[model samples]
Target: MSIFHGLSAFPLTPADAAGRVDTGALSRLVQRLVEARVGSVGLLGSTGTYAYLSRTERRRAVEAAAECTGGRTPLVVGVGALRTDAAQLLARDAEAAGADGLLLAPVSYTPLTEDEVFAHVAAVAGATGLPLCLYNNPATTHFTMTDALVARLAALPRVAAVKNPAPPSDEAARHAALRALVPADFAIGYSGDWRAGAALLAGGQAWYSVIGGLLPEPSLALTHAALAGETAQVAALEARFAPLWALFQEWSSLRVTHAAARILGLCDTALPLPIQPLPPSLHPRIEAALDALA
Candidate 1:
């Protein structure tokens, strides 16, 4: 199976207030994902603060996570950066650090044209032998990758999967449309945690999840149930996630997951600066939300 396939759990790159990675905390997070038997481990993704960290720090994050996974789990490291050369170098670093695959997003301050994104993705895909997943996170990347663009990029060598933003409804139509554009085996995954169950039921090949980053067991149960076409089982698990999912919509998944990780005692690190922590008043709600999943 492709590293990007199935339940690829992404973990927050635990870092102190100083923007320095706490590898010890990081290894523990990856260890939990490995022990849960998730299909793969996504390192340095948006949840992992890939946009905030420097190359050296990102490399350190991968080196540490690669060690924790230790070939037991496939490590798909996010190599998204502002510059094509920098992203290419990051891809190289991840491969050298033992990553099994790469996740590239069109990250630019000025909006990127399709031609620009195409060239950028092509360069990074060529940088290493590892397969790459196109990260279509318009909410963060500010560049929305269209289906035509996806089809164009899919033809590039080693571009094997796409982490798309799942639509809330009509997931089957959405999934079928994208499936028609890509290869039969090209992995078409979804990221929005609240919408993942429906996506899976509609044939989404993977769940590039945020909540699964901190809380994997329940997420895995949902993933397995949906993938197996167990409607009642998936609905039950999806209800358990309702409270937390609402929090995610309001506070954003990155901030909520940062809070969720701390609440669960998995990691106590702060998100990189300029992104403030969830106000203390939100703790009770977050607590109650987590309780639902419990």
Candidate 2:
């Protein structure tokens, strides 16, 4: 699906203190991305606190986002779970809820081997007709998907794309290495907001963006400039994003993004417990960062 090939904005899934998804808020957030004209709405991804939510709440989120998108934009719902059966059920749930595609991470409690992960991903891809994107988030998942492993998974039915961490250096070389391994049409994208612009300029087909969810126009600007190979414009736009990028690296994009959302009047819901909101002391810095973007 083309859903995996552009700016896939991952929005925060707002919920009440009781962990019940605030469907109204969730719908509003999804609609924002659609109005921004993003490639897709990436609902229930890590930024959405999918791991912290119960399956029921996740299903509710997909339902709300699907209703809001209403085919106006593509919806790529994250169906990552610790158990194979649960992931399969989530995939089925997303399809039933009107999602256009699925993003599956190698979510695990035990350290999984390459063979184990291959089987896990294959199972989920086989479970649904929707195109599946492999989520290679080693920092959170604790499983690094080697290039060879990605090549193996690409051949599986319904495996359409991948969202890897943005390269820290040599974006072209890194992107080229992976491109050589996968099929010509396989969509290759990156996350890690700070480094993503370079990845895009280096021929990354997509950006699985956290900031794009909160600040779409500028993100789209950067995406457009980079896609068009406008190096000078890309550098200028990326500079304004520098301060926020620094904060994202220091405080984590999850906390910083939730803070930005509140500041922008997007949502007032807190990050699900154990993952507290950013400290009050950091609010000034966040303000200054948002000011920089403005």
Candidate 3:
């Protein structure tokens, strides 16, 4: 099976207040996810502060996670950078560090053309032998991979999958459309944890998850139920995590999730400067969500 399948934990980089990657804490977090049996471990993803970290920091983060994973869990490192060259360099570095796959987002200060996006991914694919998963996150990348573009990208060698946010509607039809356009081996996974169950039920192969990063046991149970088409179990698990999901809807999920992780002592909440921690006013609600889920 592709490393793209099932629950892939998207962890926050456990950075300290000094803006340094704490490899020890990061390894421990990876250990927790491994213990929960997540299908893969993703580092330097959106939740991992990829855009916020410097090149050196990003490289270190990948190396640290790769070292900790040590091939126990498949390591999918995010190599999304504004410049194609930078992204390619990260891709090469990730491959050197023993990453199982690469997740590339078309990040740009200005809008990008379809041809440009295609070339960027192709270039990265050429840079490394590892499989690549295109990240379609318009909210962060400002570049939405349309169905036409996705079909074109998926045809490229070494482009194995896409980590897309859930579709607006007719998700079943959307999944069917992609399936028709791409090869059977190509994987389609959704990242919006709120809609993951529905997307999986619609035929998406995986849930590239933030919630699973800090709390994988419950998330994996939820994914298993979704995959088995056990509607009642899926609904119950989604409902159980609904409070935390609501908080994610209100504020940035990165802040809320990091706060919750901190409360649970899963990792520190020291996000890189300017991102800010979850406000104190929201503490009780976070506490309540954690308590409810606990």
Candidate 4:
């Protein structure tokens, strides 16, 4: 089984004012996730600001996460880049660094045909022996994997799962189509918005969770309830997170999530340049929403 089969939190990499990684804070963040009993930690994914960091910074961030996690939970490193070689190199580095798996998205802004997407994933799979989870954030990558492509890729030995953002309105059809593409052993992880509990109850087995970054307890609770066939409890927990979910939809998700982390005492909310802090005007309302969850 892939190490990334259950609830996974995509943590934001904490950096200092000088742009250096705050390893101490990063360690604490990882420890908190471990304490929450998250199944995996997806390092340097979108929530981790992978695109904002230098390659060296990314490596150091992964290493720090691994060190802090200390084998308590699996660490799945993000390995998507505009260049295939770069993505492969990151995958290799992640493997060498002892990451349990890789979460890959297509090269940024350059939309590939379904065949090319498969080739990209195939190349990464070939480059590193690590298990792979395809990340399909169409909002960012502008590339959506067709059900036919997912079916073909599912047969590959290393392609273990796909992390798709929940599509609008017709989630049931989307879930059914994706489940039909992959075998019973393979999983479809939900990443976008607050549909994770519903998706999980509907047969989605994994989640690349941004909300979990701030509220690990509730997030894990929702996942556990869904897994245990407690759909009503899951719905109750999802209701508590509804306001934060609404905020995520209104603003830059990355910024708001990081800010929520800081408010929750999880991290410092320092992002690299070009990715500024959440607006001061929104802090009171955001904090109030998070406090309500508490």
Of candidates 3 and 2, the better by lDDT: 2
Q: Candidate 2: lDDT of 284? A: 88
What's the true lDDT of residue 55 in model 1? 91
How good is model 4 by TM-score? Answer: 0.94
Model 1 earns a TM-score of: 0.98
Following a full C-alpha superposition, what root-mean-square deviation does model 1 have from the true structure? Answer: 0.9
Candidate 2, residues 189-245, lDDT tens digits: the string is: 999999998999999989999999888889888888888889999999999999999
lDDT of 4 by residue, 1-294 (tens): 467677888888898766677777777888888889898998888888787777777788888888877788998999889888889999998888878889998856655788888888889988988889888887778898777888898899889888888665676787898787788888788887577777777767787798776567888888889767798998798888888888888886788888887777778747887778887789898998787688
Query: How many residue pairs clash per model?
Result: 0, 0, 0, 0
Give residue 21's error in model 1 in angstroms.
Answer: 0.6
- How far in Å is the alpha carbon of 31 misplaced in model 2? 1.2
Q: Which stretches of candidate 1 lie over 4 Å from their true place?
A: none
Instruction: Give the TM-scores of the predictions, in the order they appear.
Output: 0.98, 0.98, 0.97, 0.94
lDDT of 3 by residue, 1-294 (tens): 789999999998987776678888888888899888899998889999888877787778888888778878999999999999999999988898789999999998988999999999999999999999999999999998998899999999999999989876788998998889998999999998888988988898899999889889888998899888888999999998899889998897889989988887878648888888987788899999877667
Model 3 residue 195 lDDT score:
89
- For model 1 the local lDDT of residue 184 reads 83
Clashing pairs in 3: none
